[model samples]
Target: MYCYVSEVKLVSLPPILCVHLKRFRNDDGFTKKLYDKVTFPETFSTAIFAAGQSENADCLKADEHYSLYAVVVHMGSTMSGHYTAFISSNQDWYYADDSCVQPSTWEKVQGTYGGYRQRSGETAYLLLYRKKSWNSSG
Candidate 1:
């Protein structure tokens, strides 16, 4: 018997990381959207996923971490939907939908983690994280 294995590693970590969630998929010649809840942390470290000898390895410092700063949410179905953005600025959260922007809370942002039902609702489509240091001056 023959077996194969593959590994993926991060060659570099940007100051600002953008993560895209795969909520849409093609199945049986049809496009389907997944309403699976995806829990993500407000802050995350990339050191474990980085290549030890890769370029920009210095960014994997022990105190270096990424803090969630923005989230692009999609509300509706696979065919039609509206887009909104949850942005964090100056340690405050704001929700922007079209021309209307309002103050929001972290709990409200977490609600976009999607649901178990097939019904349409706000879902996190893209996430933006900014690099920060655990110590001051981040």
Candidate 2:
């Protein structure tokens, strides 16, 4: 069962929509990363990964994971060993300034390895389309 938050007109309020993201699970004993089932929307047909990695990866890189490279649609799946970045970070993590909170306009901020590494040039991207929770104040 897949559910999505109401898709408002890009500039509308950011509905309390369900952001479901998936990732590979590994118990290497050295380091482990996992995330909630609901995080980022799986709307992007594009994927991020290592350009030269031709084999398979159901794993997370230490903080060294820099950018998010595009991967073929066929390769961005469970059996393929590719997953969303939120999986490794446990969804409760994100990069914040002195305040420790992502600014508005951030299009559903997500971090690789839980903000230890960034997928967007190690920077947060503005989700210009996403609006904050609306208010019905009179």
Q: Number of backbone collisions per candidate, in order?
A: 0, 6
For model 2 the local lDDT of residue 76 reads 26
What lDDT is obtained when candidate 1 is compared to the true structure? Answer: 0.83
Clashing pairs in 2: 5-17, 14-131, 19-39, 105-127, 106-127, 107-127
In order of appearance, the predictions have TM-scores of 0.83, 0.19
**True-structure RMSD, every candidate:** 3.3, 18.3
The TM-score of predicted model 1 comes to 0.83
Off by over 4 Å in 1: 48-59, 117-120
lDDT of 2: 0.27
For 1-138, candidate 1 gives per-residue lDDT tens digits of 999999654446788999999999999999988889998887777655653655554444544688899999999889998999999987789999999999999998998998786355889999999998777444
lDDT for 48 in candidate 2 is 36
* Cα-based lDDT for every prediction: 0.83, 0.27
Q: Residue 110 CA error for candidate 1 (Å)? A: 0.6
